[model samples]
Target chain A: MNPIRQDFPAFDGLARPLHFLDNAATSQICRPALEALVRFETDDRSNVKRGVYARAERASVAFDDARKAAMEFLNAPSPEEIVFTSGATLGLNTAAHILQERLQPGDVILVSLLEHHSNLVPWQLAAERRGASLRAIPVTDGGRLDLERLDELADRVRIVAVTHASNVTGAITDVARLRSFCDATGALLVLDGAQRAAHGPLDVQELGCDLYAFSGHKCFGPTGIGVLWGRYDLLDAAPPFLGGGEMIRRVSLERSTFAPPPHRYEAGTPPIGGAIALGAALEWSMAQDWDRLGAQERELAGRMLDGLASLPGCRIYGDTGTQQRIGVVSFELEDVHAHDVCQLLDSDHGVMLRGGHHCAQPLMERFDTVATVRASLAPYNDGADVDALLNGLEAVRRKLA
Target chain B: MNDALYDQAIIAEARSRTGAGRLDAPTVTAECDNPLCGDRITVDLAVQDGAISDLAHKTRGCLLTQASASLLARYAKGGDVAAAGELRAAIDAFLKGQEDERFAILTPVRNAKSRWDCVTLPFQALADALADLEKRG
Candidate 1:
């Protein structure tokens, strides 16, 4: 067992052991992040950037440090490129809202079939508002983006929005290849990093994406705080998504001059404590050996996939091949509803799994099933968790069958 | 073997229900889909003398939903459309942990709070079918 599991309070708080397999939905916060949140709230609680008092100055410094931490986490060129929003949903929506100005009528905004609704709906609304068309990259039978079809939309595609790792399938997109494709086509790439952020460290420059967004809650940080990393040059040119206090440099009744790149995008009092805790979360994550963590997650995922495949009527979704996937596995038992599967697992064995369309209806249509029971792994999970899941699933099949 | 949600009676009803098909030309038919879980139930009714003479259903859902549809089909054959419409309220009460005698077979589902819709979707569709019957008349 990894010693990091002891750092999470949830494992110790429960009377009985809980096999938390819903890491894709949201991860349990680590001790450092939780303490950071409490420390900010109890001691240094003050609104940031607007006050001249000592505590307020401390709060402002903490807030700016959070931005710097996030910038370093993403390996973004500068702290100016990081814009704080509520979560990935707001970050993607802000990206779409800003990009709408550059879109012309008949222009295409290409999205993948495997995107969570957060990534898909924003681009859809952007297309509708700008009179640009929206297109979806088809998913192959193995539940990966069909990269060969990139040339088909090369002429008119202004933006290519895709998930770095699918929340449903766990298939990691080849973003480096995608970057080459976008470069060849003169299209900007927007990567949704909500599911990928916790799995490993990310370098925005290496990925060559114009914009990247991720939610804090999904990555062992506090909720209501997320980062939107855009290239500084692009953010400077894009219009603001929201208008209010703190985002403006100077405001009069007649007109207001907006603040520079990041501050202009972050309108109003942001999530102060949550952002600080997120910084702590990233710092804790950076201090760890990610190669070991990745290997542990992959081993857990492999154990789960191999166990599920051996079952009589199980149908696992996505690239069942062990190579390029994160620790997420989605599957369905024959003639069994996913909700029932999950409910039984919860009630019987204290195993928690996510059961639904996973907010990817297009991908659901591709699989011709409405929903699947998903068990996502994190660094904290061990082989015992996989055994618990397998035992619970076997019991469910025997009883329900 | 000791699963409270999928007991022997519920599993038996789910597996052996004769209401697993559609009526060719029914008096009224209604379909409802639980978008959250993608569970769908379609109810077909054949009314005679203002009462349901025959009830058939097709369900693509969990065992609870299939069992609920089976129980509803078994009881709704001789019941009037008005009584059939009232099953929704009765099932809703049962799902809320209340002991409604009308839907007593579905008592197992009361404990599964997150899956209440699975047990009630079929009844909701039956209610809709009854309403459609009244609208046509």
Candidate 2:
């Protein structure tokens, strides 16, 4: 048994054994994070940054501490650079709206084909609203981004938004290379780290990207919370995303002034408890041996790919090469609808898999399929979970055949 | 074989491939696709004297969808085109766990809630084909 599996309460609470393979969508929240949430709600319950009482002060300190934790997690330059939002979708939308001021007519917003709808749609709406064009960085047949074509749109590219790791294909993008391109072409690289944030440490300064966004729920934290880390200069220059309480410096009859970058981006009373829980989640994640976990995930991914390949009439998608991918595997069984496969896997084998486009419909188009059955892994998954998935798929093959 | 959703009856019907062809100069044709699973079904009909003289189908889908299409084609031949529109309603009721003897062949898929669209794609295409025929007259 994997030692990490003991930390999650879902494994112990289940009536029957469950093979949870949908971690890429949303992971099971860890014990520390859940405890932090309950403790905060019970002990230090108050509106932050408003009341002068002791509980309110504690809430304010915890919220600020959570920001510092997020800043440290990303290895960002300063805590002032991290802004909390509803989730990654809102974070990307905020980035797009902030960058929209710089986008002139006929300028281009370059996004890759592997982006989730969160990363793709914001830029699309921004381009439409600002009279700019949106172009996709084409993907190769083996699911790698085609970087050779960067020069084709080099002149007019204003912003380059790409995913750090694809949810569907599990292919990890080379952001360092993408950063170098952005350095030469003067494009701001916005990385969607929703899928990659939990896999390993992320250093915004080391990656050399202008902005990064991620969700807390996908990283074993609470929902309704996310982080948007940007360069201080870029964030200070951009306008406030939402207008309300807690983001203003002064209000007058004629005009109003906004606060600094991080506070300006946070409009309303923030998710104080959620932020505290996410801080605990980040602390718990940082304590793990990521190098060992990464190796284990790669080994499990390789085993899953080999097993699926040996199955008759199974067509696995994306880069089967485990070197540049995470444990997310998307595949189709011959003559089996993805929904049917998922249903049978759950009902008979207690194996939970995701079926559909994985929220990347354009990427699905690139693969020439409507949907694929995806089984993703996390640190807690062990060989038993993989065996359950394999056995379920084999049973489906024999019964359907 | 334990707790398997796809029974031998449904598998046999799916693999039978009965009425699996295109009709020559068909009077009405309709196609539908379940985009989530990429299952497509096309229904072709030759209507003469207000009756379906011939019924055929082409499908790219799972065993459940193929079985449903085959069973529909087998039962729908020589039936009135106007009556084909009722097939969709009957399937709708059947999927809601209703007992309809006409749609009893779909009982194997009753518990598979997510796949309700699979068992009804062909009937939906037939309903559309009937509507198209009515528009022409």
Give the winner by TM-score. Answer: 1
Tell how far residue A258 is off in model 2, in angstroms.
Answer: 3.2
**Residue A190 lDDT in model 1?**
97
The predictions' CA RMSDs to the true structure, in order, are 1.9, 2.8
Candidate 2 residue-wise lDDT, A1-401, digit = tens:
78887778787767788799999999989888898899889999899999899988998898888898899899999999999988899999998988889999999999988989999999999999999999999998878788888778687999999999989888999887888889888999999999999786689999998889999999989999999999999999988888988899998989789999899999988998999999888988888999999999999999999999999999998888889888899999987778778878988899999988887888988989878999999999989899999999999988774
Point to the candidate with the largest DockQ: 1
Which residue pairs overlap in candidate 1's backbone? none
TM-scores for chain A, candidates in order?
0.98, 0.98
Residue range A1-401, candidate 1, lDDT tens digits: 55787888777756787789999999999888899999999989999988899999988998899999999899999999999999999999988987889999999999989999999999999999889988888998888999888788677999999999999999999998889988888899999999999886789998999999999998889999999999888899886779998789899999988999899998889999999999988988888899888888888888899999999899999877768989999999997789888988988998999999999988998999899999998888998899999999999898775
Over the stretch B61-119, how does candidate 1's per-residue lDDT look in tens digits?
88888888888887787788777777888778767777777667677666656778888
| Predictions' DockQ, in order | 0.59, 0.37
Cα deviation of B54, candidate 1, in Å: 2.5
Which segments of model 2 are wrong by more than 4 Å? Answer: A250-256, B1-4, B17-35, B43-57, B71-78, B108-112, B120-137
lDDT of each: 0.88, 0.88
lDDT at position A328, candidate 2:
94
